[model samples]
Target: MDLEILNQEIDDDEAAYRVRVVRRVHYLTISRKPTAVLDIDTLCRPYLLIPKLPPFPDGNWTKMRISQAANGETEHVLSWDPLDGIHSLWHPRQVDVLSLKRTADHKARVKEVQFDGRILLSKVAIFEWWIPRLQRETEFYERISKDHCLGSGSVAPTFLGHIMEQERCVGFLLEKIDGRHPLLDDHPACEAALRKLHCIGWVHGDVNICNFLVHQSTGHVKLIDFEYAEPFEETKAQLELQKLKDEFSQMTER
Candidate 1:
């Protein structure tokens, strides 16, 4: 049996899909792209189909499949594009997040906040569609705060504490830093900042210039946005590293 997402178009608030049954084959490999999108017609073994509830985090990062990159070598397969999708969040920002109100997708500074243990907290993480990213990033920062990370791990903003709702930890508080995105001239700073993370045996998955913050006065660099970051894998890291290199080099070329 074959289950294919016919189209991403919403049909009564849910995506419409199609299932097909075909003849036998030797090996079965699943690609992230649908067959129709792949524009391929191949016979598959007809098998029993059973629908079941999906596990929590069905879309977790653990699920890896063949996909394409932007402005690069990609087939006309309808791959999962994170850059796509209509962001119609019922309640974009979380309720009572802070006096100024912020979302989990960005970084902002509020007045110095003090918790029960007299710990200071300024930066905050709110619940939103970025819940998974926030949780994973917070945990990574926690390791840095406790000096349990590799390399210096000091390239990240300081972790103050967790934001609590009753007894549940819904968000986190991190140290606020005033900085700007790296410009073409600040490419060296970007490389140094990225090298720090690589030295720690992790890759800064998103190698965009916007993710590298250059200090306003001190001119130091820090890395942010760990939504796609993971432990270092030589092959993948090299590709991402080249992109990091290209970001600056390309600007210079232009």
Candidate 2:
């Protein structure tokens, strides 16, 4: 596909947003499934991508006919018009930018960047709905830090701070780990990490292989993506454990 994510302008009162982009897609060679090329920006610099959704046009109009001076059609750009979209702003200067680990989607975008002389993972939210989860996670780390009953060690990456863009708190930063996702052999360590969280009256609401990071040199397992996590409840904690068990079982079958 000859596609590139270009920034387009959609001004005037008709459209509510000033920025938008359509789409550039590439299909998997084997599956032929299309995926958006949202991470088209270069490495090391910071960017802010917000959701640009405008109000829909009033009518079930499918076809649009543009009129000429003699023809019977209105040549006006109304509130309802054909549009592509906008996202991911990239600057052309040789500036330090974060290495994109994943594209900016509605849920979240992960990137690697240099912050305070340390390489950290930046999980940023592109939409307003997801911003709360990042805020909750920051509070989660704060609570853990104050509690004296739990061990000093943390199974999750160290919480760095909030990622601000356009004067908005979108997400939080975290210590980047040099590790890979847990495999069948790493199941035991993964469970041990999960249990450690439960022992502290917290349930990692989302438990899957992807959320568990196994360290390279130490072989330590760490949990991530705590968007669904919450205070410990007996039933909820057991359900989270069962989710881990089920995932391991499926891996074993594979």
Candidate 3:
């Protein structure tokens, strides 16, 4: 992946700045996975250089300097005060370094790499805008990983670690469930998994069969895809639970 700086401009007051960057990813492999290699300048600096400007009485701006790399790659610099809506302007996405293994969707991609001599699965975003969604799913997995009741086997796979690039988290690694069989809608384990999630104050927003996997050898069922899973409110949780129950019952009758 190569990143080229097209243009950059800063305001006279040094209160705001914008940078245009063009990124290109040449797949050394035969796969057509979307990948981004960002050249972030300010983050590489040893310290932030704040320019002298009339300070807003209410807040202050965080100034950053982006230095150009010897390889002709330019960095982006931005300055904004949090109280003045910095988040709306400069959204920082977590970046990670991982090789592309497979492509999943328009925004999501999968990578398989050797970790500790074991092949693992990596879920990453193909574009910058998709980073937040992937981060949310990572947070959910991390949270549920600590629950003793759910156990590691009942979840999708073991989380290895996060992939970081330019001081941001872009993706995460997990154990590869290569040979698992898909679950049936009426499978008893599906209900049991949903029950466990609800008991732990979470609701698997999507209860389809594709999200549940059955290990071929062990026969242990694992729930996957927490992108839609969220904290269960009383009324909403019951409603979703009952809906899933009705769907499963109907499947059984059929």
- lDDT by residue (tens digit), candidate 2, 80-182: 2332211212112122222223333322267776766777777765434455676666567667756743232578887656554433345566678889988
Better of 1 and 2 by TM-score: 2
Q: If candidate 1 were superposed on the true structure by all CA atoms, what would the RMSD be?
A: 15.9
Tell me the TM-score of each prediction against the true structure.
0.50, 0.59, 0.54
* lDDT (Cα atoms) of all candidates against the true structure: 0.48, 0.54, 0.49
User: Which of the two, 1 or 3, has more lDDT?
Assistant: 3
Lowest-sum lDDT 10-residue window in model 1: 20-29
Question: Which one wins by TM-score: 1 or 3?
Answer: 3
lDDT of 3 by residue, 1-254 (tens): 12222113322222222211122221110111122122234312212212211112221223333334457554444445221110111123322353333433222256566656677776655444456667667767666666643345455576667665333455677777754544343366666767777777788777766667777776667776676778877776777667766666666677
Candidate order (lDDT) = 2, 3, 1
In candidate 3, how many Å is residue 2 off?
7.7
Report the Cα RMSD per candidate.
15.9, 12.3, 13.4
Question: What pairs collide in candidate 3?
Answer: 94-168, 94-169, 94-170, 95-164, 95-165, 95-168, 95-169, 96-163, 96-164, 96-165
The ten-residue window of minimal lDDT in model 2 covers: 24-33
Over 4 Å off in model 2, which ranges?
1-108, 148-152
Error of 3 at 56 (Å): 38
Name the TM-score of candidate 1: 0.50
